[model samples]
Target: MFKTHFHSFAIALLLALPVAVSAQDQKPEAPYNAQLIVRQPEIGQGSPSFVPSPQVRGMKALSDGKVYLVSTDNKQLLAYQGNRLAWKADVVGSCPTVVGPRKISKVLLGPKTILVTVGERTFAEVDTATGKVKVADGQKG
Candidate 1:
């Protein structure tokens, strides 16, 4: 009777040992960052105003403090100087009008030109000097 009772108690203890070890090894939940804000302002008298939407896709700010936005949807490029939109021009060729894949891949600013690339195709000198677009072969289009 003594041996039977001891064996049963030992078996119970062995079964509970793994559960206790796992509980001790469990990790606590991670804390979230408090700096990010996503909620839109509620409709009220003194709420923060939103900026007017522009017809552009990927927006990039230049070193000259000019904001450049590409409208893949409209097949055009735009430039914003200060709070006012300064320029808008259509991109050459049959490219995706929406700002996504198959659109203008990259934009580079030179002393007097802006270089734009779409996939493997490249446009070397888009003259920004007189707000004119010149193709790579040195012809105005």
Candidate 2:
């Protein structure tokens, strides 16, 4: 009876090992940054070529866990984690209807912050964790 109980206890400990290990192995999700535009560098005829497009947006997901929705080319940015919307915010306010073309000129990333520049005058500061939007007015970006 003693040997039988010892073997059973060993088997029970082994069965619970994975659960304990997995709990300790869990890590907090890190904020991810993705570009609305894709830039490819290629060698053409022994020369370097760098190309960028405004309308073409791409997604590279290992699985369908995270999905990003970009509104009006690159004006607004949204991110969905799993089946829920992780965060949503207007990246660059509504561009003029008749002014220069609407485009994201520069994207700056800092600790827990994301800033997007539109044209030469508009700047948007977005919270990376919660997707909060803060438009900088009369500020040079």
Candidate 3:
């Protein structure tokens, strides 16, 4: 009898998993007060050198308290819970230099997915949870 009850309970949990996951996939609602601030670069001593601040290529705040950020200098997608860094995923084929046109230019947040666009043509669909690239460079997954 205990084994039968345990099996039924496990089945019920499995059925509810999708619902929980789907709810977590939704984007954050309006009145989002999270501001993206790119501070001005500070110059060092000796000779004036230009330091690059955090330039937001794309940013998205989810309803599940996850804030995703992509900087112009770094071609990696960063996930943050509050001020702490949660995870980061590199944008496929992206270079570290901020000079070229190959950097991530936009980030679109969908109901169930996040899409990162490079330049004007390449699009990478990234997973919200694991930061994995599901589809890249317009390739179907």
Candidate 3 clashing pairs, residues 3+ apart or interchain: none
Q: Write the per-residue lDDT of candidate 1 for residues 1-141, one digit (tens) a residue.
A: 999999999999999999999999986532211121112223342322112234223333333455455553534556655445677666544333323344455565554566665434534345553445566432222
Task: Write candidate 3's Cα lDDT for 1-141 as tens digits.
Answer: 999999999999999999999999987643223445222223332321111235343344434456676654646777766666777888746432233356676666654567776655677778877877777754332
Which of 2 and 3 is the better model by TM-score?
A: 3
Candidate 2 lDDT by residue in tens digits, 72-115? 46666665674456877765564332123365555544445556
Clashes of each: 4, 0, 0
What CA RMSD would candidate 3 show? 16.0
Stretches > 4 Å off in candidate 2: 1-72, 82-84, 94-100
Q: Model 1: how far is 59 from its true place, Å?
A: 5.8
Better of 1 and 3 by TM-score: 3
TM-score per model over all chains: 0.42, 0.42, 0.51
Which pairs clash in model 2? Answer: none
Candidate 1 ranges beyond 4 A from true positions: 1-63, 94-102, 137-141
Q: How accurate is candidate 1 locally (lDDT)?
A: 0.48
